[model samples]
Target: DIEIHVHPFALSYCSHGYRPQEVLPFTGSMGPFFNVFCATIVSLSLWRIRNPKLLPLLMWAGTAYIAEGVAMFIDIAGLPILTDWGKVIIIGGVSPVIIGILGIIFVTIGSIFMLLLMPLENVSHRDSFGKKYLITTSISFYFLLSVIYTSIFVLFVLDNRLIAFFSSIVFSLLLTTIYNPIFPFLDRLSHTKTFQIGWSEVKIALGSAFGIVIIVLVFF
Candidate 1:
């Protein structure tokens, strides 16, 4: 007999010939652990050895990776909570509630650190860098926002996670190209101190907002 099982998190159904007697091992947790570990190492390495002139770029890259890792961890750990309606829960023999709490703490700290670091790095290095850096940074932030929005939308609508992930990435890249025409305006605006400072702050704020949105989506 074909047994139909609905996945609460994915909001999709699958079929199996027979119910397995043994509990299947969840290998999903490994991806987040790997992401966190690699990102931490890369961030630390960039801070220690990267050129001072590239401070803003390095800081942005480092913080982005760290945030991504933390987001992934929260998403994976929170899946069980969505499936079962209970305050007390366990997944893979560990309490995902605890993992979710820790993920929140890490995200909070990381966001605050990024908020402080982005503006300071931009202001400090403004004189050394040129219009290229400013334009690049602006476009990078825009691209990131596009990716996040697209990924979330696609993941919700599509049943296949891998296909949704890659499709979002491709579509995000196409969407970001729409901003190419504004590059000239951004380059001109880069000459002003006020605009630079304001842009830096805005970018960091949006970044933090996206992180929070991801966490909320995963949990709720």
Candidate 2:
């Protein structure tokens, strides 16, 4: 049900005009180093901050670093990138063109929702409608970004366009339904005393994992 224009890069690269294989060696080598450098800066900056909200950003960074590291290694091994799994998700790699339009819609919707619904800094307190709104918007944007990136990765791998669009609609609607109901309960749970204690534990674990990610990226 969606229409998309394939990026010009796909067309330009088809004739071995600019072989991705040539760049893969360099990118596969340097990407992790760059990620490690960035992670180091983030880890240092985070030590001076007390706001727990930044944990999500750190986790996202760590996740991408790990994923890129895997993808790069796979590329080095002459294998398809791990990030290209979106093709697998799109009905067994048959019709993949819809991902581009889906990406555009997701990003546009997410950005608009974030601009309108993201809360003020002091809206962190429990039982506030602003807090719930912020959580909903954040979760929505996270999923949208995840899907967009994966779809782009698949495009990079497959380089095929002019495929069916309707196949992905049901999956998107299902995800919408699943995420919408959970946020209300998540908001309620956050206000409980037990949740506070559990949250602290989770925060500590995330902090530890963030540090470990930085160490791994820097060293290995």
Top candidate on lDDT is 1
What shift in Å separates residue 220 of candidate 1 from its native position after superposition? 29
Regions of candidate 1 where Cα sits further than 4 Å from its true position: 1-26, 49-90, 124-220
**Model 1, 1-220: lDDT tens per residue?**
6543422224333376775555434543443455456655655566544333434444453454444435545455456553321122344555665656766666544443332233334433233334323432543454455456445764554434444345434533432343245434443533222223456555665576566556645653
Q: Report lDDT per candidate.
A: 0.44, 0.38
Candidate 2 accuracy as lDDT = 0.38
Residue-by-residue lDDT tens digits, candidate 2, 43-118: 4466345244454444334333433443333333432442332323232442333434443443433333222212
In model 1, how large is the Cα lDDT of residue 111?
40
Tell me the TM-score of model 1: 0.38
Backbone clashes in model 2, listed as residue pairs: none
